[model samples]
Target: MECWDAAVSSLSLALMVLAVAYLLRQTRTPTRYGRYVPADIRCCSARLGWLVQEVPSFLLPLMLLLLTEPDTEQPGRTRRGTGRKLLVWTFMLHYFHRGRPVPLIIVLSAAIFCSINGFLQGHHLLHCAQFKDTWLTDARLAAGFLVFVLGLTINIHSDHILRSLRKPGETVYRIPHGGMFEFVSGANFFGEIIEWCGYAVAVWSLPAFAFFFFTVCSIGPRAYQHHRDYQQRFEDYPRSRKALIPFIL
Candidate 1:
């Protein structure tokens, strides 16, 4: 079991490295989604795509939580109690509820990726990760939880801002203003990145770190592309704003 877990962790790390390489190439050439939606690709409704992609993130974790048994008696395994379970569930909830309109292919690919990630994270947290209830009171966990909550709030708010940008029957893209958009073109992506970083910090596990690494690799480049697109489309786009970072990058 330990060997299997180690293998999975190694595979996750490898995926993260590949994601970084892919991002390097993608930054030069954006994917065909969002503003760059390809004419050739057939896409379904955004809401449907979102549900298809994100539902597994929530469901798989919940299922794993219900099915798995923690290794409380193991010599090296720390007994994570309700606090750790709550943290894991919180992560799952973020994906379960959040929705965004995206291309069919994009959502399909995301669904596949996230399903695997959800299983790995859920399995690890429920059956593999060792945490004590008292760990919740630790400075690292407390700080990380606060950061996670803040990031989740920013992410949801940013999404709301984007959705509210277009009024009824409006299809044209507009400059997103207010909130973190004042500082970054991809405020939602930035918020997500922060959220996962906090998750990694709070969990302090290899799987969590791998998840965070993959999130940065995947979302960071997309944010860069969005920033470029905004700059090209809107001459009045904020010059001070960065891509994914607030005043940096």
Candidate 2:
């Protein structure tokens, strides 16, 4: 294996291992954010916190693209390189759209996660991935892209359902209905998990796959917690619904 490949694979593997540890930790003690924020914890403006924590994931890839030049002397290699970079940038673009009151601890931890993931992904694109001209025509890529689009549609629709459950300035939580919510309490989480899984398939890179594993371990617990919380808080919550998946999880 090439040095970059070996390094990326090793790093990705390490991330996956850490993700397992994180999963165990989260299982024992759920993350303390959203509705579960601790009473005495420090807090930050959601807008500012989100911007700061999430920017690294966006900026690092951009810098990698701008500051580094491809092997332009080899025209085919240059095109492939640019393709990888574009895909990497696209992977992180969705993070630009979220903001709410967040715990300072959450912000700090998320910032670290974002920075590590941003560097791992961006650097992998810059140094490791190599695509041929026919990659665009691959059937698997097409299928993966379709899955990604589907997941994104589901995610967006589910978000709308959740948001609509509450009127403006309403602090009470209501059981979300419609869309994927009919089947899973964490329909939004389900969609996002599908989104990243599809992205992994599209890239067919170890780094991307590792990131998917990390995404699952990281957010999967949160989704289950959400499910349990809903069941406990609302006696009328749909009994048939699962946690992060439809019919199973």
Candidate 3:
């Protein structure tokens, strides 16, 4: 392997390790954001937080796309062509998960996470990935694409369901119904997990796979915690529903 390959592999492995650490930390005490916000912490407006968290991920890929040289062997394809494709599709996805005031620590940490992910993904795609001319027709790619679409749909719909639950001036948290919430307490998290898993499958790269692994480990506990919260909060909560994965987790 070249230096780039070694670096990326190290990054991928590091992400998985971080995932384990995050899972353990979150399991003992949940993240201090959203419903679990601590009594006293620095915070900022949700809009500003979203912008900060989302911009690095978006901009890094965009810059890579603009700066990377074209692949000489491919006639028209640039080194970061795949990054461009991803950026366009992902731009819309980033805007969906807005929220109330967010803790400053969470916001900054999330931004750093996104930035590192953006760098890893963009760099690998630009420098290391190789594809046959027939890659578009590869069964794995096609199947992964379908799965990614399905996951994205579920994620957006689940977010909608959650957002719709609370009306203006309503301070009480109501049980979210409909969508994947019928089957799993953390439908949104589940959808996100599916998205990254499918993304890993489609990309078929070490970085992508590591990202997927990290995503599962990190969010799986959060979903379970949400499930536990629901059960404790409402005695009438659906006992049949799982935490994240439908009928399983």
Candidate 4:
């Protein structure tokens, strides 16, 4: 378990570094589906792609959570089974609603990546993480939970806003207004960033921290790319709004 944890942590850190490099290059990658889909790649139905990619996130954790037993005697393990269970459920809950249409390659890659992540997180929490039931009452936990909820709401609402921009047959892009879009160009990305940060704080585990770092590394660059694309595509795009964060880049 220790070896596995160490390997995952190392991989997460390496990915972060690669993400940083990606940001520095500023070359828009084809990973962003929908309006930004690459011209060369043959695409498939978005709904099917979403299911293929995101289902693992929901299922892998659930399976691990049900099958694994906790190690209470481990040095850093929290003694509260309830807290751990709640954390796992919280993690699973987020994945349950995450399906959205995307490119096939993107879905496949994400599915593969998330499968490993789900296993790492679920296995860690169920078998290795040591939290006490009393953790539920901790101020940190409460604050983090609130932040997580807030982020989730923002993420879902932002997606809705984006989706509503297009009518049934319309393919044109429109400026998204209302909600966090009024503040940040990548409101959904920002919300996801906050969500994972809150998760890291609430769980306070190496795996959780790794997951948070990975989220920032992966999504942060995409947000920047989206911001750049929007600015280039629309002459009247808002100049005041930042990319991933409101009023700050």
lDDT of 2 by residue, 37-91 (tens): 8778888887889888888889887787677665443535433344566577667
Q: Relative to the true structure, how large is the alpha-carbon lDDT of every model? A: 0.81, 0.81, 0.78, 0.77
Off by over 4 Å in 3: 1-3, 74-100
**Candidate 4 runs further than 4 Å off:** 1-32, 70-80, 98-100
Q: How would you order the candidates by lDDT, starting with the best? A: 1, 2, 3, 4
The count of backbone overlaps in candidate 2 is 0
Per-residue lDDT of 148-199 in model 4, one digit per residue for the tens? 8888999999999998998898878888999999888899999988898888
**Cα miss at 128, model 2 (Å)?**
1.5
Candidate number of the best TM-score = 1
Residues 37-119 of candidate 3: C-alpha lDDT, one tens digit per residue: 87678789878998898677677766765776766556433433454366334433544466567899889898998888877
Give lDDT: candidate 3, residue 209: 86
Q: How accurate is candidate 2 locally (lDDT)?
A: 0.81
Q: Could you tell which candidate, 3 or 4, scores higher by TM-score?
A: 3
TM-score (C-alpha, index-matched) for candidate 1:
0.91
Tell me the deviation in Å of residue 119 in model 4: 0.4
Candidate 4 residue pairs that clash: 77-130, 78-130, 78-131, 80-131, 80-132, 80-133
TM-score of 2: 0.90
Model 1 CA deviation exceeding 4 Å by range: 1-3, 74-77
- Candidate 1 on 21-41: residue-level lDDT in tens? 878878677877777876777
